[model samples]
Target: MAADEGLTGSSRVTVFAMFGVAFGYATHHLDARRVGDVAVVGPLTPGVEWGLLWQMARNCGRATAGEAELARWVLTQATRAFVCGSGRIAQFPEQGWKLEPGGKRVRFDSTYANRDQLWTGNLTVEGLAPDQVAQRPTIYTV
Candidate 1:
């Protein structure tokens, strides 16, 4: 969890990855937005630092329902849509996504999630050992 804390505490590269993007749609699905809830991206609302809302989530020792919802959307809908959108480009130099020239998509996603169901897309190698998989399994066991 050290790496997770480090990245969450401070990670310029992660922030840099979100630098430029132009989408007409509003964040957090718009309708879901409420007082003290600021959406950073589609269905992704980052709890404000030092805010009461964030404090509650922190004190609870897990993401609030809103954050969990956003996380679900991120791993499933958001990331799935994003990866599928690369239908015309090369994900890696060796692998092209074009439908022609024998380019095919295996529909794979490498995102890490607490619950296996959260990653609702095709399967591909994510560079994780069997025991290492699901490293952050959901805290609840219902």
Candidate 2:
């Protein structure tokens, strides 16, 4: 996952999409600033590892109780709330996210942590394969 604002790492976009704007609100609910140009790449089916997602969510619950609480609240409010305050218009054009023709891999440095919370790093997650319908993900860190 990458954003025009900067780079962070996670494959939560698919699950996050379910919450729509509420997901953004849940993610940045404590911050006054908004996000911009967020993008993610991963398989939707055949490769989307749902088990991994569930494990991640479970791990999140165990590691960050406060965040889990906020996520729960946001999920419950997703249908009725219009969470329009958490994101801003992207400064870069959509075309800037494209890769060369027939390209199938991308490389970037991003944060990673184990589900057990024993290790973490800003290691390069190289050669990621974007799904057929997804755009190339970009990682920009300051």
Highest-scoring model, lDDT:
2
lDDT of 2: 0.24
TM-score between model 1 and native: 0.21
- Report every candidate's CA lDDT: 0.22, 0.24
Q: Estimate each model's TM-score.
A: 0.21, 0.21
Looking at model 2, which ten-residue stretch has the lowest summed lDDT? 113-122
Q: Candidate 1 overall Cα lDDT vs. reference?
A: 0.22
Model 1 over residues 23-129: C-alpha lDDT tens digits?
Answer: 11111111334221211211111221212222332444444455444334433322333345421111221211101111111111332332222211111221223
Worst 10 residues of 1 by lDDT: 7-16
lDDT of 2 by residue, 40-94 (tens): 2211222232223223334545455443342342233321222231222111111
Clashes of each: 0, 0
Q: lDDT, candidate 1, residue 5? A: 14
Inter-residue clash pairs, candidate 1: none
